[model samples]
Target: MQMRVSDEDRERTAQQLQHAFSEGRLNQLELEDRLEIALTAKTYGDLLGLVTDLPAEHAPPVPEVVELDSKNGNIKRSGDWSVPRRMRVTSKYGSVELDLSEAVIAHSVVEIELALDYGSAKIILPEGASVNVDAFRSDWGRTATSEVPGRPRPGHLSVVVSGKTKYGGLTVRYPRKRWFTH
Candidate 1:
């Protein structure tokens, strides 16, 4: 059976090439060539050549799960951490914060399931991350999201947030970049 390639697959391959370039693994010309091939790839096999010589992405030691109970303390995860395919965040009288600026997201789309009860949750994403609040239900609570004002790029990561909040607040904030910086 032939495997079809998705846009996300192409995007991820390109992103891997970009990372290799940033890490000095590939020269400018080689990086450009690989990126072109990745973006134009039509099947999974086509992307294999670009990452054949590179190191593989490693998964976290444990199942990627972040949980916060009724501890009443602040919970934070940031800086080069592996983002799991599914993230479950539950806060009872506590605050939860997730920073994805420097995170290593292995997937094109991440699912965040939040359960807040009399607490607050905040997600801080990078300047170009795409976020969608598919479903949000709050009882006497509030939810607000501020995203990067542009259509999602092909090689960008997107986040999907869902779940419920009762007497709690959920906020998603993205970085505001300067004109000089991309």
Candidate 2:
């Protein structure tokens, strides 16, 4: 699925992250790592944790929760049954959290989508799971790519968003399973 981040939310998230880094709660490396992720977070929910680390002034609070049941499951049961992956977020505009541990698939496939309209957001994937992420960025032509456990495929898969958000121009698609788009 393709996720999105809002303009107003991104600005506020940066402020909050700076506060957390300055507060001594997050070391330089930790702050940098998390800050980078928060700043580029495509979904407002992705910034949830990053924002929470900052001072209260950075991120206020909001009340909301949205969940999407797994699309399908059917792969032959692996010897072990590990918990699915989980993702959570917190930021100035609001916060959102999710647990994918239960999203295990036996064989078939599952798809999900999220759009950032308010704050920050994040995604959690299982070890063997695969993902395709195309994020929207302001850089003239900066791009990122990496190899997760599973092979990357093509399909639409989006996520919940927050605050003054805009498309990074990037979108994620599914390969093995059904994918949702923003």
Candidate 3:
């Protein structure tokens, strides 16, 4: 598929990350990790990768790519092969079935927008993945590091969530890096 990274996404990610870095919210390790993610991100998939390793309570809202016309997808660049796909995860929160992983992308580093209705959310990436997310106007997210994975480990568990949060919040966690972490 074909995807285009908008100037808005680029600018937004840069500013948020710059603010995080300036505010000492990220340690040296975290700073480097985000920078790597930012640099490696070309398509939306690479940008989405940046949000994979966060805690469940801080996932940003993902836009409704499904509603977009596919005509705007998969425009082959000089050397483009694959496009990013959606990974939707649904969960039962009390009585309502919430799509927790609706905005979830596997490997992205660009800027993402999330809509939150209740609590806070965040994203945890690898050694070199940076993400910037605006969760509406109320919810906020801070950086976190951990050794645990989010989704169920019965299979290759990749989790995702975005927009219209109803309960506690959202978080995405990347796997443990045998090599390095950011």
Candidate 4:
């Protein structure tokens, strides 16, 4: 028996077709044809046929754990860096800044473990990303999020922050929007 396809299935197929086109795997005409058929697909088989000739989508391999440490200086990561699945950041009397607005995030969820003393950690997330700090413990310090939610958003990245801080601060926020481009 042929299984029926849902709207989500059709949209996913369409996105795959678009990705193939952008990757130079499909020509403009081919993409259009596949997209039209994908949009009108009535069964899973129909949608599957559209992308059968293309290479399978594969996510980049993420390291199990990445460690970032500092003792007396600031640590900063920004501009198109690859995000690991799990990260451990340690600092003492030094601030840590992670800017993920233009990062290459492969996973749907990211875990960050922090250890700090007399320093602050600032995380800047991309749009539509959510962060949770429920597992974080700060003694003589505070954890704050600005204009971002603690729960995960649908079809968006979710960040889980955990660890301990002593006389330090943790802040998570989205990038600032610019109204004008020079």
Highest lDDT: which candidate? 4
Better of 2 and 4 by lDDT: 4
Query: Each candidate: how many clashes?
Result: 0, 51, 41, 0
Per-residue lDDT tens digits for candidate 4, residues 20-87, read 88899999999898889989988765776787677756211234577888899998989966688999
lDDT string for model 1 (90-112, tens) is: 77778878888888777887788
All models: lDDT?
0.72, 0.41, 0.39, 0.82
* TM-score, prediction 1: 0.59
Q: Candidate 2: RMSD over Cα atoms?
A: 17.9
Candidate 4, residue 66: the lDDT equals 76
Candidate order (lDDT): 4, 1, 2, 3
Better of 1 and 2 by lDDT: 1
Compare candidates 1 and 3 on TM-score and give the better one.
1
TM-score of each: 0.59, 0.31, 0.29, 0.65
- Distance (Å) between predicted and true CA of 112, model 3? 21
Please say which candidate is ahead in lDDT: 1 or 3: 1
Question: Which parts of model 1 are misplaced by more than 4 Å?
Answer: 1-70, 149-152, 176-182
What is the per-residue lDDT of model 3 for residues 70-108, given as tens digits with 9 covering 90 to 100?
121221112212213442222222211222223234434
- Candidate closest to the true structure, highest TM-score: 4
Q: How far in Å is the alpha carbon of 43 misplaced in model 3?
A: 2.6
